[model samples]
Target: MSVDKLDMQSPDLVYQNIEKLAESFPNCVTESDTGKAIDFDLLRQELSHAVVEGNKERYRLEWPGKKEAIVTANLPTTKTLRPLLKESVDFDNTENIYIEGDNLEVLKLLQESYLGKIKMIYIDPPYNTGKDFVYKDNFAKDTQEELFESGQKDEYNQRLIVNPETSGRYHSNWLNMMYPRLKLARNLLSANGIVVISIDEKEVHNLRKLCDEIYGEKNFAGEIIWKNSSKNDQDYISTQHEYLVCYVKDKSINKGNWIEKKEGLDEIYKAFDSFKKKHGEDWEAIHQEALAWYKQFSESNPIFSSKHYSWLDEKGVYFPDNISGPNHGQYVYDVIHPITKEVCKAPSSGWRYPESTLKQRIKEKLVHFGKDHSTVPNNKTYLKNTEFQSLTSIRYKDGRVASKNLAKLFGENLFTNPKDPDLLCELFKSFELKENDIILDFFSGSGTTAEAVMKLNFETDSICRFILVQLPEDLNETLRTASGGAKATITRSIQYLKKFNKPTTIAELGKQRIKLCSANYTKKNKPTIGFRVYRLDDSNMQNVHYKPQEYAQANLDLFSDNVKSDRTADDLLAQVMLAWGLPLSLKIERLEITGKEVFRVAQNSLYACFDKGLDETFAKEIAKDKPLRVVFRDNGFKDDTAKVNVKQLLKQLSPETEMKVI
Candidate 1:
């Protein structure tokens, strides 16, 4: 907790210092008095090495073969085009995306284009239930080889039968499966973003500790309890609730507010009318009844008005709220009610507005009168618009209502559990989303996040987009068959099928509404392929013998042509932008005015250029904006003299910007 003890250095240095501190405070360092020295040093070394090894292994798998030509590329360039069958869904217009594959591979693939940009991520991962199978992650094999061996023809490479009870290291297997994916996911989160993971009692405690280690204990938000099931089983106590552990990327940034339902003026008017009908125009009786009703309402709806008061002479009611405060000095005065022509007293607390304003209200007949017009003195009261009230937190019960509706739309429960689209919609509504804000969901089960985002866009007329990722796991066929005879058969089929007649056997009603979505869907002008796919490969440099003149000519030609046909450089820059997970509308400007071409990416605040034979003055001009990041080609400098002092020049000119050369 002490700032001085933190060392205020890099992670490696801080960790080393922590170990030194632990040695000094042995009793405090050890959780128990076992007298055994804590292995903090060993643990840190193992963890750091493991992370490095995992990343290195993944890189090798992604880029397995490259024989000097450098023909291969990282990430997928071949797009998969599929038909848009559902009229309700528009794949191209919607910002949301649903990718079917192993989450591990998907996360790794995303690392090249989406790092540190996600805002809010919510995932319901496999709970490692004793019966559940753990993900079979073969970190050793090459990606292509692994895919081939798994017998996955145009699908996820492999599947493993992971029964926790039978596994030698149940907890360890789950940890290994989650570790790298979480590490990569953390890299994708924006600094102010938060991630929520839904788990059961079985692994809730373990997951909490794991997230703390990954996201830091300081970033841990509270655990939310979601009552998933309502019915009680007779055999034993029925399990109902699940836990959602939340953690933020950084604790310093504001996370905004949660969404809540609003009680409109119509509802307030209804309450008033009900109260008046039950308890006649007696001011005291009406006030008492209204107060009781409001209290009951507030118990269920936390955003309800707290204070209630009856109008002085009228049967109407109002809540005590400060319309104005102590800024403007005493402009207090009396006013006459327009209807009753009775004089109303201004509060001794001072009029809410200046005397001029009070006069304007009197002229406009905005004041009210009492029931006993002649006997009771009227007082000026401020009217607060109910619409302007602040929204409150929406509870889990409200979320369930929305989730049930979505369940009905799918016909059958397509997913064991789906997030309440309404809850997600509420969250989206709270933010001032632009058409370009890219929402991501790495745990996209049945694509609920995409559906929610699309619905929000339809309702708010905003063009916010989404990116959804889900592993292709086959549904249980037996359950489907039991649910609905022939209809169930269609649902259980691997290929998409339409249903014809309901309440009829498969033999009785031969007709079916089902139609299989095309594997590849193409546009009119462009190829049917949906995505541009590229595979990772090594650099194209080979060792060989050549004459000095020939070598120099080849080098010069390569350097010159590299500027003209530098697809690799262009692709790398694009991937970097994607890795950063910036919006697609981010500006890209290419300038060739200074004999060397430079690319300026406006959104990421980055400028990169790999042109050879660069000019020094041109470089200085490009560095003027103090971009957050800047990259230059190692071979592009005018000379070694120019390259050596470039760092110093940038340091003095753009102190806040980070400079790197490739």
Candidate 2:
């Protein structure tokens, strides 16, 4: 068989949708001049029992660029991610990924490999505050219009456009930018995955409506009102809170409540363990010592709030709770005190649990009583049993904590308003992630989510991974337009980047933050602490590789090969892995097989050799191990006969292996 050629482009979403429709409603799908497409009239008829009409007014979100936004989400991108070895901390083994690119294109490129793979997605997108910059997607801009507008934008490639209030389509522009990115993000989420978006009051209403439509109103999980700051700057009312809007991919699949251990519970447990070690089974002495220890903390402290849980037993630290029912006349029963061997004084309301349960608790030493029979028996609520609590709708965290921590890490205030990693850690823990589960943050500003994931893994001894994507927004250009404190902050950031000989961009700053976090980590038993850095750029292939027919036959000889002149074999391998639906984290090993350099990926899963002079001898040598898939450079073969013979040799030796060329 003729060798198959790699597409070297992101998966075509429109075609995938058509195939999905065909599977569900075969009669509604038909072949068109362009390709397989859904017959709209037939599809409408299939959904309704009556005759379908056209152009009905429905309650839906509408904007000037809604159609264009839909088109943008469906459009395939030819952009590919090029791995940067120098920037990466641990390129070979780390499962964590850090990507610098326009997140829209990055999301499109990740569609196939990470489809339904990510467990959580947290993004702090631009809140459409009029001053913030939003991405100007190239597909939405006409060629002539783009040329005209290029001069109006900044010198940083004109990829970002400031969305000021003076713009005519202010809300429309923000919605257009967000819609396509959110649409693409939804595809990466697993069936039970959830996405949390941070927004302020500036665009929260519009954001809620947009997410309600995209994630389905039924899957709209509750929102968190984070009282992070006490801002008196607002004239009307002091807006002190921001929102974390959460939505599940499929509500039906996401069962159970999101629960997390209460803050300071770990410290309380540690203290209790120490008390037990010192006092042994002396319950009264442990309780007295614990109460004395708790007295040192203020009432505002979370640990101090748990002071009532000082009483100890073999079951662990506990507090006495009233066993009385709501009313004054329910479930009254006789209970004899163990020490006095006499009937104990019953509660006025009667027991909370039934008589049989109360008896079992007394027998199991879970019921606490007074020294004499005069006092009512109480229920023992163990601190260990009540460690986890349901996530609250409102949370209080000082926003400056994150900024201060980041400043200390860099020894300068390099970023503006970084999110709190501790807060993100608590939020992620509510989901109870498994080992290797991915947490993706497309708008990874300051890399707080990366820090949070690493800290979570280290503390819990779990191996969850993170994928962070941030645009390389130039800080030098930003400093030019910035004013007051913002300008000073940017100047400091530029100096910091210069100190490290790094680029003056937001992506670089984020990378440094991650590196600092890795360096500062003191734990010897690290849990996937580093990340592999990849940057989105033009594909490794030349124009002729994608559209050879566009070039004249006479000029074909001038091209040496389909691959780009400056691209390396490693770049080609990355694109090939992405095109083949393999994750970028797969282990790669370089080997020399009979003189030709070959890449052995994930053991015997895939093998690729981009070097020239391929022949039957090399093919026979590689085919011995029998990789599931193999790729070779098209022009690398010695001759047509040599290429044909290699294919035949592989077929005879490893019948199951599929051979392709790029």
Q: Which candidate number maximizes lDDT?
A: 2
lDDT of 2 by residue, 1-662 (tens): 89999999999999888889989999876544343568798799899999898667588886667888899988877778899998997788888899998899899888877989999999999988887788777666665687466333433344677777756567777888999999999999999999999999988888889999999999998899988886789788999999999999999999738997766667767887899999888877887888877665425453346436467777877778888988778788899988899999998888788899888888899999877899887899887788888887877788999999998998978777789998988888888876888999999988999999887876776778899999898886577557788788889999988987988889999998898897555377654367899999877778844322212123322444778899998998888778777888888898999998899999988999989999988998999999998888878899989989999999999999988777
Model 1, global lDDT: 0.52
Overall lDDT per candidate, in order of appearance: 0.52, 0.83
lDDT of 1 at 18: 48
The alpha-carbon deviation from the true structure for residue 473 of candidate 1, after best TM-score superposition, in angstroms, is 1.4
For all predictions, the C-alpha RMSD in Å is 16.4, 12.4
Q: How far is candidate 2 from the true structure (C-alpha RMSD, Å)?
A: 12.4
What is the Cα-based lDDT of residue 98 in candidate 1? 47
